[model samples]
Target: MIGPETPRRTVLRSALAATGTAALGVALAACGDKDSLSEQANSGSDKGYIAGDGVVTQLPPSKRGHPVEAGGKLLNGKHFDLADWRGNILVLNLWYAACPPCRKEAKDVEAAYRAYKDKGVRFLGVNVRDGAAAAKSYMRTFDITYPVMLDTAGRVVSALHGVLPPEATPSTLLLDPKGRIAGRVVGEVDKTTLKGMIGDLRT
Candidate 1:
């Protein structure tokens, strides 16, 4: 069970671990509130990038929003639509190449996908930044086998803006079989927590 906490130390660790030594020169920063992320991005603080506060929220069916309507060309140039995944549990991970937490959690997300792909679950990545070359490089580095959408135009982000905050890289969203938002983790994903969330949806 993944609970929520706002410990600055924990947040720092996750961010640094994801960034690796090569990116250490860049300052690590984050926003506890979704709106704060937008403000930070506009102000050019830390390049307007936002790391999550390690918060996890799961909504009951009644609390979920309407089915998400988003899709676009993938890194492989394939079209993807959220609506088409309605019958299976879906996971959407929003990330950019430079996000430390995204780097840290890539392996775990891929593991989860491999574990659940044949069990009526699907995972899609939404890359908010990076061109094909950079995005593909990141995917290769992380050994990510899931489909990742190139959301450079922010079309997918705009569609999911109701639940996903702008500039909140490394945010993970879970959708129930019906395509409505079911849960979210706003930072480096805890592997056990993610698997537990997926298990709960199965039941």
Candidate 2:
């Protein structure tokens, strides 16, 4: 009997099974076909998780939700407090070492971080499902210097559930200078799009 405590991947499989083939097709169609994530979702393989399509959603200031308050321990065991980055635009990326989309976008994400590091734009990775060693290795592989919060138990996910649930690995959230969610990229992010999103928040 799969319950609430069951792993998300198992839950996904169970849900898909219960939905039947026709419903699965409809669900895949709703996710769109342009992005790699959607393609992977339709591949009928357990290796690929159902990440969001490459849709970028921006919320205007009036419609923006409450400020995000979340924190966790980094892989290096340093404490991270989102409140400390209140005055800066923060990019929170949810990812893990095994996810292909996460691996694909790592370099671009790192590049964006480096490009905006001096402009009051901070990038933090919320490693959702990887162990410390694997997450550290992923960072090393991509030369990602940004701090990644080790969120093995999904604490950060629960904290930001009101704004953006960490349902999809490789999701990116762009928070405005005031610590409120300004935008979201629901799949592997492109460098140009990420830079533009940060630029908009910076200005």
Candidate 3:
């Protein structure tokens, strides 16, 4: 049976109720799932977003240094040595699974790793404030083919610069073959953008 038309307020209430139901569905699906949470964090109606240092036109600025001391291991049960990746251009990401933009870029990073892991290019993940389980799950979920380290203490967090405004989560810092700082990306980036920026290694 058809129901009679209701007042404008009643229609608005019904619309809101429907939206709430959809949101609940999304939450239920991602309950306790790290990758799912990451995907949800990055999902929005916005078709695209251009993130960069616009007006100021200035980035963190690259510095010269060797062998990331604050890096390696302090959180994970094991350790990682920056020296091992010497002689290779590498993409270094400092992120937390809980960070929205980090999740958004996780897949792109993995794809790049697979495409260049054999081309003398490397990808290293530095996880901060995230345990082994979450970090592992994130890697597996995204089919990541690279190695990651857990930096629970975030000791190297301060040393690894080159992030944009927010300068908080989803930060990407590049390291040259000699372990020196090379530009950075503060938010999610596409494969083409990454490829272009990585070209700096030649200089």
Candidate 4:
């Protein structure tokens, strides 16, 4: 919570927390008024990145979680297409090795993963600002076994919303099998609270 961490150094290091978008207008205004609809008709079968059909099943713009980019790569060099994770419950967290709060939440995240991973759940980690080495060390020390993507440039964080410093580290986002956000822990991981939320999601 010291000051804004630069996107170059560390996305998570910027002391940013979930500010949540104020409105889609401000969020989308920068794009100007481009009628993507017109492009779809002209292209016939849309396949390009900027085509109107580029978006599939838009998941109510996430004010907290990532925008679910086209292609995300894991630390292990695996690929995660957002569409593929649709059928399994996904747990997402933004963390950094230096954040004290993130360190505290690591154990809880590991415990939850251990408990629910085999029960039709998937966990994804976004390590911003830190490299594979730091992430590996942290994972090793904390016993985290889930697959995580290294967010070298913090694109995922930017997609969530501009973070504010003193923001809670280890922020959590729980998504249903359908990929919609079911719950979030914006400030630290409260197992009692998270577990209760998880119980609700199952119901």
The numbered model that scores best in lDDT is 1
Models, CA RMSD each: 10.2, 11.8, 17.0, 13.8
Best-to-worst order by lDDT is 1, 2, 4, 3
Answer with 1 or 2, whichever has the higher lDDT: 1
What is candidate 1's lDDT per residue for 1-203, written digit by digit as tens? 12344323121111101111111111111222334333434443234355655556666675554565565567787877767778999998888888777787799999999999999999999888889899999999989999997767655544444344655677788889987667777667867878988998899
Pick by TM-score: 1 or 3, better one: 1
Q: State the weakest 10-residue window (summed lDDT) of model 3.
A: 10-19
Worst 10 residues of 2 by lDDT: 10-19
Q: Which segments of candidate 1 are over 4 A away from where they belong?
A: 1-46
- Model 1, residue 32: distance off in Å is 17
TM-score of decoy 3: 0.61
TM-score, one value per model: 0.75, 0.73, 0.61, 0.64
CA lDDT scores, all candidates in order: 0.67, 0.64, 0.50, 0.54
Name the runs in model 4 displaced over 4 angstroms: 1-70, 162-168
Clash counts per candidate, in order, are 1, 0, 0, 4
Candidate 2: segments with Cα more than 4 A from true spot: 1-48, 159-166
Which lDDT value does model 4 have at 119?
A: 78
Candidate 4 per-residue lDDT over residues 108-163, each given as its tens digit: 88888888888778888878668999999999989889888776665554444422
Model 3 agreement with the true structure over 49-158: per-residue lDDT tens digits: 22222111111223232333333453335665657667887787777776666666778887777877887888778776688888777777777767777767654443
Worst 10 residues of 1 by lDDT: 13-22
